[model samples]
Target: MQDKTTLYSLRKTIGILGLALPILLLVTHQDLLSSMSHYYYTAGGVFFILILSAFGLILLNYRGYPKQEGESFSDRLITTVAGICILVTVLIPTKSENPLGTLFFTDYPYLFGHESNGFLGAIHLLSAASFFFLLGYMSFYKFVLNHDASASKNRLFRRSGIIVWASVGALIIIFAIEKILKINMDEVFPAYTFWLEWVAVYAFAVAWLVKGKIHKDFEKMIKTFQTEKSLKKH
Candidate 1:
């Protein structure tokens, strides 16, 4: 059990650092933002890689855990929708000449100058909007609507939401300052937006960690139910 605890602690630390290092590098090395397109592509790659690594840790930890009797249909559905939204975001860059030329491969000039009439351009914008909406909605639902105040399992959810929202608020404040005060921090910190975006990502990761804890509690509840039934039958 101590070993398991240590492993989880390590995973959480890595997850936090994975979200932080990229931002720190971007902020400290703002010159990199001159190549914004490349920075975004690199950031996206890093995001996906980190997500997969986190998932792998989760799978390892849950190995041999008993499955719930019934499938969580809502969870599965939302996950599928989120996955599709992410796929659309990726495919749009690969297929559309506009996004492809600007974001994916910089071999050619951005003919549209970030405003393309191409089908893929529209798809890309739509995908991004949808991605944000879905995440926001899902986060609200999981951390707010379904939260049980009396349950100790819900503490993580509450704390994760607070952290994620606080980070998001900070990012928004920074953006407002840049726009209103004409303070271009980008000159000093390349890829500022990319790094700022990670706050939201980091929030999601923390939320996932909390969710994992709640899931374990749910699993325990299921086991207790099963045990009670078995004892009654004896």
Candidate 2:
């Protein structure tokens, strides 16, 4: 029971971080970058790095539910891989065409600049893609495991998963079109990448928050506060 509570709390924390990430970046830096990854070049770079690093550490340490019979890959393993990939995304900055702030580490010895280290940028993109794919997979498949398909929570999970997957697809399509046609969608859409990434992040957040039973936790907290107030009055 205690372990279950701990897991729920951890899920809630992760969800909160996911939900707050974009908003925090927007507020702190007051500038919307082309993509969330581009925030690495802004003042929000610290938040971007620290939050993602925290995610990596938490997922790495996460034990997840015990493995059932015949289960090939446990939740811990999937999450660990996700964690590693997210860390890679952070450590290897994306191709920063337009830096918003002081270009921090744009000139690192051998691991910076798209012109100098294009391969590193490729690794960052690949790692980021893998990370988000795993997140969608977990939200869609693993979270709904052992639950009735008709269950409201399961439905919510599926919907969120679909949104995440769709966002990823849209991003891919946009990238392909821009690469082939040599036209920047952001020219007209203005930060389309950031918006799509925000949607995917928030969708993941919603699924995890629901999985954490955050609603029930909030209700319980409210009741506890009310009970304390009544006791004091009495």
Q: How many pairs collide in each candidate, listed in order?
A: 2, 0
TM-score of candidate 1 relative to the true fold: 0.46
lDDT of candidate 1 over 1-234, digit per residue (tens): 225455445435434554564555355334343222233343344543344344334423432112234524243355446556655554454232222123442445433223344676557545544544444444555434442443554555555555555654655677578879887666666545555556556766665555434456569899999999999999
Enumerate residue pairs that collide in model 2: none
RMSD of 1: 11.9
Give the 10-residue window scoring lowest on summed lDDT in candidate 2.
108-117
Q: Which candidate is the best by TM-score?
A: 2
Score each candidate by Cα lDDT: 0.48, 0.82
- Best-performing candidate as measured by lDDT: 2
* TM-score result, candidate 2: 0.89
lDDT of 2 at 228: 100
Query: Cα miss at 113, model 1 (Å)?
Result: 13
Tens-digit lDDT track of model 2 for 87-131: 999988888775433344455542443533578877988898888
The parts of candidate 1 lying over 4 Å away from their true place are: 1-31, 34-73, 94-104, 108-119, 143-192, 214-234
Model 1 misses residue 230 by how many Å?
38
